[model samples]
Structures are given as structure tokens and as C-alpha cells.
Target: MNQSPLVIGARSIDVGYFNVKFTLGRPASHGGPAPVGNFPAIAPVLRSGAARHMEGVAQPDGCVVPINGVTYFVGPGAAQRGSGTDARLVKEDYATSDRYLALLRGALWRIAGDAGDAGDAKDVVIRRLGLGLPLNTYFDAAQALRDRAVGEHVVGAGANERRVTVEQARVIVQPQGTIIHFGYTNGGKPLEGVTMVVDPGGGTLDWYLSERTTPYWERSGAYPKAMLACAYAVADRLDPGWRDQPAIVDRIDRAIREQRSSFTVQGQEIQMAEHRPAVEQVLDESIDQMLTAVGKMDDVDHLLFTGGGASVFSARLQKRYPRLKKITRMDVDPIYSNVRGFQVVAEADLASAKGW
Candidate 1:
């Protein structure tokens, strides 16, 4: 068994489909590591055997990273990599793979590094960790993920060989994380009525209803392909050939994230801003799909939106579902809201456990 760190409490992490955001416990002690990116797949920077954290354009000293023999750019500066037919989006099943775990370690590395910047002399240790799993993930799968995340040691050989340890951990369903977030932020606002949470993330669109009094979630649904539809639609408008090239598709997706007006396609410029209509059209379709799956959530008093991708289309969402009496707006970055909620939940759990 791995030894626990010399920390007083648990730290929380939210591993989203698009990003990994985490918060340190008693940040005043560990130094604050603001939410870090889950930038995928490390690439070896040329000539040094050192891997770059995220995508960027090739510098005079840079080269591309390969995954399964496919070369692509990751993280920042990705736009400079130019377009390729083999570029790929790096996503994995959090419940079944190490991708999310690696990202979690990445978050820890940032925390420790930040602590160093803050003049702290000890490495960061999380006595407990709260992890978020996608809604509708099976119980067994979530348990497996929780088991893997807790007490699991990860050494980021490419990421400065940074390490993080969790003495205890618990998994919160992703949608429920949003609910806890809304409830905690609302403060005494009765969560008694029906409330719906729609988390449109990079990989999945998760929706669930909670009847605030019962401590249970209802009618939870996961729409796996909804978030990608907009990117696909925008790509279709830009280049019919993009679908055939994972790299080009990824670039288009990145362009969407950067809110860029254009992206390169085999040395040609494809205007993205002009494709807003396509994006809106696809977004409408996605909403329609969600509405169909969610059916009519009658008497939904609270409609909270929290996810990395939620803010951009939240206005549209609010307009589309105007019947919701109170639309909760997140005061913090929507991407970190779920994790913040997870932290809140973990603290509550610890409090109950410790009789504090």
C-alpha cells in the first residue's frame, strides 16, 4: 500500500471530457493551483527527449508528437502545427482507462509546482480526493475508476515525473456534481422542486433531474455525441474532406474552441466565423435531441448549466427553456464548477465521517 501524504484534508478533482480542473485542499497551505488543463497526449520536443505539455506550432526547436503512429499537435500553439490528415482527438473512457488518471496527475503537478512558487517546502499530499465520473457511468465502472484513482501512483515521466497520492477517495456522479454545485451556490434557496442540470461537455451531453428533498437523482441520461455534433457541422461547412482527416477535424474543433474565424486545411484557409450558422444549426439540433431524451421536465424550478462548453450556448439554452423559474448562473468558470461542487461534497463527506 502506498503511504498517504502529510496533508490535513482531501483535495478535489473534476476530470471532464474536455479538461481536467482541480482545487487544492487548504490552498493557503499548499499554494493555489488554479484549474489546470487536461491537454492530451504529450509530444517529445525535438532533440531533447523532453515532452511538451500541450499542442503548439512548431518552433525552430520543436517537432510533433506521435500516438499510435499518428502525429499531431496538442495543447497551446496547436494552431501553428498546420493541418494533417492523421491528426486525432485524444479522449478516453474515464471509467475504463488511464487517460483521466494521467490528467489528474497533471493537475497535481501543477499544484506542487505552484506550491513551490508560493515558497512551500513540502510536496503536496491529498488525504482524500473527490472524483467526478460522467453521468450514467455504471456502478461497477465508477467503482473501478474510484479504486484506480484512490491509492494509485502515477509518475509523469514525460511531465517532469511528477507524482500525486490520495489516501482516500470517493466518486460523485457528474450530473450530481452539478446539482451539488447549484445547491451550494444558491444558499438556502429551496431545492425542493424539480431541478434539471444539463452539462454539455466535449465528449458527452449529460442531463439529470433531482428532486431536491430526496437525496436521489432521477431520469438521468447521457447523450454521448451531442457536443461533437457542432464541431462536425462546422467542419462539414469548412471542408467536406475534414471528416476524413482526424487532424483536420481536430484542428477545426480547436478552432471552434479558440473561437477563431478560420483554420488551415492543407495550406488553405477555411473561414470558421462564417460557419456560425452551421454551428447554431447543429446546436439547435443538439438541443432538440436533448429535449427529446429529457422529455418535458415539468415544474422544473431550477435549470442550472455548468460545463466547459455550457457558457457559450447558455443564453440560447435559457431562451429555449424559458419555463424554468430560476436559471442559475455560475459565478465561477463553468468548467471548474463541477469540481468545486465535488470539493464541497467531499468536505461534507469528510465532516460527517469525522463528526466535525
Candidate 2:
């Protein structure tokens, strides 16, 4: 008789400026609510009883979706809800925000369900979760994000109007999840010499040098110009005044990330392909800075690239620096590399506990 593969559920989750990625023992999935339009602190309306009822009521507060008595609005949906009067379109303090927490918990519950064999809703249980943060985040800050994430439980709507409870969840971090992934993909090979890890995320572009597989912390830093900036660059081309229009900004962000051929402008659809040059230009500007930094790192034998931003612009990056072919280059699906790496780390831990 043939043996079946073990059906264990271990997932790595990455919440970035562009999207929320979840990589399981199986394939990866990137879907969660993002902010609906360009409105500050407002997320798109998530479908709920109250929101459904007020669909056509011209909701000033946007459509509110309450979870555990805390209201929220998910991304890429109808209606919208603002975080606060002074909320931003993309918050740097996302890890601790109630709305963000609601989103994270909701995503985790869905990922768990995707793992299958989901238990009944009556019993609250603890689950192991893996998380990743940008390279620039200090150890203390990353720990803070992890600390806040663990032991977190939330009650919210799940598939088919079912209620989901995730309790006492534990979260761990291996900064940039991509590093873990690189190690696994290389057949657990020990990295030697100078290796440059470039992780360009939604909100930041970060890189570091590693010697013999250990990161040289002193050489690593982060830049704010990243995927979001690329979207902004595209928006600047479509309309010089687009910043004032939140919905337009939202559309541009979705269009660029989703690779939509066109985006709406003032109720009119415009071809995004026409502005491709502008997008590439903005991305090139960011990557150039990263390359400049790498050049100062003496002699690098390997270059590892991961992150949605990197995935989005890798082809262009490679094209610009054909010399990239000279190095021991590794470029996986930038979106899930980090999360998948995290999953691998979690699995190793699980295996060790079972003495495997």
C-alpha cells in the first residue's frame, strides 16, 4: 500500500503594505481585506448583517462590520470605514491597531479553515502561528509585534455565516521570513562568503549582508520608498491631483498590484498599461538605491531577493543589472517566500517536539 503524505497544518503569515500572504504546509494564499479606497484609516466594507441592511443608506461612517463588538471594514469590498478622524491610508502602527488585529485574526481563522479538519466552534483552542516583519524593525519592535500577536483570540464571521474562534494563539518571528525560506530551498546548505539579502516590501526596502549565513546587522538598513511609492508614482502620472481623491488612489493601488490593465479615474477607466513606464521608473529608483548599498558591501557572492515589491519588479531589476546573472542568485515568488520560510521553521519546531 502506498503511504499518504502527512496532512499537518503550519502556515506563515505576512501582512505588508500591498497584501496579506498566508503560506501553509501546502500552497500559499494572499487574500485579506485591504483598505477600500484612499480614505485615511478606512477599510472597505466587509459584508455583514448591519452593512447589508444599510447598503443604500448613504452611510457617512461607511459600512461598519463589527467583530466581537469592535467595528471594522475589510479591503477590496463595498462601503468603507475610517479608523479615526486622523487615520492614515496606510498605518505604520498596524500591528497594534484594533482594526488590523481584527483583520489578522480573521485571516488566521480562514487560513486554519483552509487547513481542513476544522473543529467545531464550541471549544476555543490555541493555535501556532508564524509571523514576519520588515528588516528595518529592531529586535525589540519585532518582539513587540510578536508579543501582541500571540495569545490573541477573536470571534468573527467565517465561511457560510459561521462563527470562528481563535484562542491563545502563539506567534513567532524570523525577520523577513525570506531568510528562512532561502535556507530551506538550498537543501539546508550552509551559506558562506558574502551574501546579500534584499527584501523590498510594500512600505520599505531593506537589505543586509550575511557572512557564513549569519546576518551582519551593522550593514543593514531600510528605505521608505517601496511598492506603495511605485503605486504613488503611477497615480502621479494618471492625475497630478489624485492624492485628493481617495477612491482613485485606492483604484490605482489595486490596479498596479493586481496587474489590472486599467483603473478608474473620476468614474472613467484609464489604461494602466499606458503608464507602465512611470511605474517601472519609480520601482527602478528604489532598486537602484538598494544596488548602491549592496555595492558598498565589499564582495558579494550571492544575492537573494524576496518580498511582493521585489516580485513585482524583479524582472525589471534583473533587466537593469544583467550582472545579477554573475552571482548565485535566488528569486522565488517574492510574495510567499518569507511566509513559506516561516512555515518551514514552524514545521522544524513541530518535528523536534515530536522527535522526528
Candidate 3:
């Protein structure tokens, strides 16, 4: 309920896992905020089934345990998933990262470096905090190809660098897209009516269209161009000499935060509206590319946008198809819409597996 800010409901979060946003549809009968776990319970739910999966227990639900008078739901997931393995790896890889984060925070506070660290730091945090495996597992796989040295180095001194860049991972279509569509459509039937989804996220721009039967998506149409590009575009237009500045990216972020599309160069206002025709142009082209990808799915009816990007680019969307009746932005951040959508799908999978 980020957008409409809906009250949360029926949530069974892992016992003692804090950081969870639990907003019930109605406040608890006492009408006071529910207390959250303030500290990690050393042995919460220590003997649950999930613990069996993790440290070997008899049940799937982790056993209940108590530490310091705090009841802990030490389940299979926490060790099998949370701090035990995952947190260990993060602590390993980013050994100095908190110090780095503090440094980064200080720099950002001082406006010393780019304020754009949110995206990069997010990426770093995501890679570090991912489940199942550490990031080195991913990066090492890519490095393996370099160690093998495919095709005798096609280019020059920069060739290996280019190769590595090319090998850098990308979002796979099926994994993410399949979940995205299933959010509303169940992934069995094509979304009916003129449908468009604009998913703008920390890393990329996702666009889609579908009308019927087969989910509407154009693999190539899903561009990696992100919202920060818009911010950068605005900056370049305002500062003619910005390319020469080390603080250019930071200043661009600063300008965007300030709400003036352009930056100050020697006290002259640069008309960003005139400068980055490309951001707007890309917006339009992206829509067209989407239509081309989905190819007139005649049954589709709406244009729905989700992602952090949507909040920023809503005006551009309003201009794209002024005629559509339901040109709506998801009531939540687009990035998380797909997440909640996936949660629904995952729950459904669990039910279906149980013969529901």
C-alpha cells in the first residue's frame, strides 16, 4: 500500500525478524502499533522444521526457543536462509563495507561524491545480501570465461575489459517477466485488453504490452535505460563543460533533487526542456517499441506502470496515451509491485502444490 498506503494484513513474518513492514488492514484491537523485534534473537525458533533444513531439526517449522526473555522462532529459514549463511558471506565480502558505507554516507552528506550512490550501493547491497549464494559465485563464473579467454582476444588491450563488460550479467527475461505477468494474469492467459506496463527500476526500464492470450513482451524492448539517465540527460544539457568535471554525476543528482531540470554553470540557467529532448524522446520511442513488441494484442485494455521510476516519469506517461481510460500507475513502487506480485504467485504455487 505504498501508493494508496493500504493498511497491511494477515502477515506471518518469520518470528523476530524485524525490518518487516506489517500493516494490518485495521490496527490491532488495542489500537496501538505492534512492537517489532528490536534486536536479533540469538536462538529464535531454534528447533523448527526450517531449522531441520538448516542445522538439522525434526520439524519444518523451526522450534521455538528463548534468549534473554525474547521468544524466538528459530525456524529452518533463518539459518537456512538469513544470517547464518547469507549474512556470513556478506560480512566476508563487504568486510569493510560498513566502514565504506559510513565513508560513503559521509561523502554523500558532504556532497563530496555523487549522490547517485543509492543505485550503485543498492546494487552492491543486493549482490551482497542475496540469498542461496554469495556474489563471488556469480562474479567468478563470469571471470571463468575470461580465464578461459574465448576466441584469442578479438581486439586489443581494452578487449578483455570489453569482454568482461559484455559478460556482466543481465536480467533474464523468463525469470523476471514470468513473475511480472503472473502478478495479475496468472501466466496462463495473455492479459486481455490494450495493456501496457511501464516498469522503471533502480537498474533498468522495463516496458511491455499485451492484449490477449500470449503475454505481451518484446525481449529487446525491455531496455536497461534507467531513470538516472533522465537525470544525467538533464545535467548534460545544463552544463556545457560538465563532461570535464569530476563531480558531474553528483551535481546531476543534486540538480534532480533540487527539482530544477538543469544545473548551474557560471550562474546561467540552461533550459533543460530544450536540452534533453532525448529523455522525452526515449520515453515516446520506448512506448512505440512496446507496441511493436506486444504487436497490437487486441484484447488489452490498460496501461499500468509500476516501479520507483514510475513516480518520476508519470507525466511522460500521461502524455503518451492521453486517450486510454485506465492509464494507471500501480498504487505501489513499481520495483516492489513485481515483488508483492511474486509473493502472491509463490503463495499460489504453495497452495497448488498442496492440491488446493
Candidate 4:
């Protein structure tokens, strides 16, 4: 009798427009939390000639990945050393773009490296891979996204290269991951009645309405006005030229997240207090649009918030719905909620497949 290949485990990668979150499921022996992390969703392409020179430099915050003959420096510091072009992908077709693949591969490379599996011939094989698509695109693009994800991928370059095989992939509406995560963390108790999840991300404000876990497709959708909208509005007021610079937008986002009244730009300190009204105005408009889409909330038993912008919109959401509950805790960072839920779902599916 032939022996079957050992199933290492499952992993999830939540690739958002502004950031990429991932989770490597916890080991059986460990009773603690799973290993989870995230990096900015910036993948700067490098020409073959330039990539060769990068081999000698040390990248503490990011890595260089080669996929399909193209090279990209992905993660935090990548934008600074990358070519002068904007590396952030905000287009609707981003799920199928080269930059998206590069970020996904780069994240796998990082996970393998951190787990001490880099350069191993045996490879790090994830039995199941969980991913998410924005509400607006989930219907039309989820299948394509899953197809791209479920396969063998070689990440990194030369000596740093590592093989990662995704045996299966599961794609869900981005915000749905939060509810799944919420239930998993709360002792597997099923959510009662109707639940609405409002996920404010960088590029979109995605909402999902469901009774328990079954979705109400008609009431859920995404709005393009989200964090970037505030960033752009603030940028336009600060300097119209800054609107095109993702780095500037990133800085503004950080400031907004930190609740800082000022930020630095090209060695000069810029006051952000003047831009508060603009940010509030845009956020208010986004909240109105979200409310309009979800219609009456009287039937909603639980109103939850998640995603990178969860905290940013928490106040407005709480004020609007006094019963609003944030899908976050002291240990759970809202940004990683989706990927964590992905891991939970993957592990459960794997268990069920084996009749465990």
C-alpha cells in the first residue's frame, strides 16, 4: 500500500486593496493563538536588470518575488525602492492582475520563511486556502479568484525560493469572514436572528446581511466610497498633486488611524486639523450610503463591524446603531479578523473531509 502525502495544514490569505492579511493555523501542541500577520498591499515591479542588483541588498520589511518571468518587490519598504510608478492596485480587475499574484506569492514566501520552511524541497503545502472578494465583485469574480489561488506556486528567487502548493481554495464575501471569526472565537455559539456586517476597507465599504450564516444576497453589497475616499478628499485639500501619490495617501491614512492632527511630508510638517471636516463629511456620506443599502435595521439582531477601517468608522456606526458590536477584542485586531476566520473555516472543512 502506498502512503499518502502528509497534510501539513491549512492557511488563509485575505488580500485587501490596502493591506494583505494572512494566518498560518496553530499547531496541535500549541494552545495559544495562531500565527497571523499582515503587510501593505504594495507590489512594485522590477525589471530583470534591476532585480539582479537587489540580490545584494537586505530587505528587512519585504521580499523580492519572481512570478511568470516578472519580478516584484512586495510589502512595506517596497514602494520606496521600487520604480517611480504607483504600485497600489485599486482597479476593479485587481483580483486577476499580476500585482495581485505577486502580493499573494510574496505573502506565501514570507509565511514559509517565518515557519522555517524556505528552501525546503518538500515544500509547505496548505490543504486548504481561504480568500475573500469584495461584495460587489464576489459574485462575478470569486470563481476566477479561486481558480488562480488553488495551485502550486513557487515564491521568492534563486536560493530564497520556496514551493507552496494550495490543494484547495475557498472564496467568500470579504466581510462574511468576520462573522465566521466572531462565532469561532465565541465558543462556536451560532449568532441569533439577523446579523449585518459592515466592513470598511481601503477601497470599498462592503456590507453583508444574513440570518445566522445564510446570506440575504439582495440586501448586501459594496460601495466604492471608503478609507481611500477620505484620504483622497484630504489629499485634495492638502495638495492636489498629493492625490496621485500613494505614499502621501498612506501617510494620511496612518495619521487618521492614529488620530494625529499633523503629519510630515518631504521634511515638512503639515497640519491635518484643517482636513478633519473633509474626512468627516466623506465618512458621513459613506455611512448614509451604507444605511440606505441595508435599508431598515429594525430586523437586525446584531450589527457588527470589521476590517482595517473598523475603528475609523466605529464611532459613526455606534452612534447610528446603539446596539452595534465591533468584531474585535483585546487580542484580536480587526484587520486580521477575515483571515483568521478563513483559517477557522479551512480547518473545519479539513476535519470534516477526514470524517473527524
Q: In candidate 2, which residue ranges exceed 4 Å CA deviation? A: 1-9, 26-50, 53-69, 75-91, 115-127, 157-175, 190-192, 240-285, 288-295, 311-322, 328-330, 354-356
Q: Write the per-residue lDDT of candidate 1 for residues 1-356, one digit (tens) a residue.
A: 14433454656777655455676554454233233334433222223333434567544222233323344333333333333332224233555654444445555555544444453213455666788776656455677877776763534344234345666788877767767766666673536687777787766777777788343344666666544566777776656666645555667767765678788866888887688778777667767777776776665666777675675556567666665526555435566667776777777777778888
Which model scores highest in TM-score?
4
TM-score of each: 0.72, 0.70, 0.40, 0.89
- Give the whole-model CA lDDT for all candidates, comma-separated: 0.59, 0.56, 0.35, 0.77
Order the numbered candidates by TM-score, best leading. 4, 1, 2, 3
- Quote the lDDT for 271 in model 2: 89
TM-score of 3: 0.40
Q: How accurate is candidate 4 locally (lDDT)?
A: 0.77
**Residue 352 in model 2: shift from native, Å?**
3.5
Lowest-scoring 10 consecutive residues by lDDT in candidate 3? 123-132
Write the residue-wise lDDT of candidate 2 on 55-82 in tens digits.
5575442223365555565433322443
Per-residue lDDT, model 4, residue 94, is: 83
Residue 69 alpha-carbon offset, candidate 4, angstroms? 4.1
Model 3: runs farther than 4 Å from truth? 1-194, 209-214, 217-220, 238-278, 325-329, 345-356
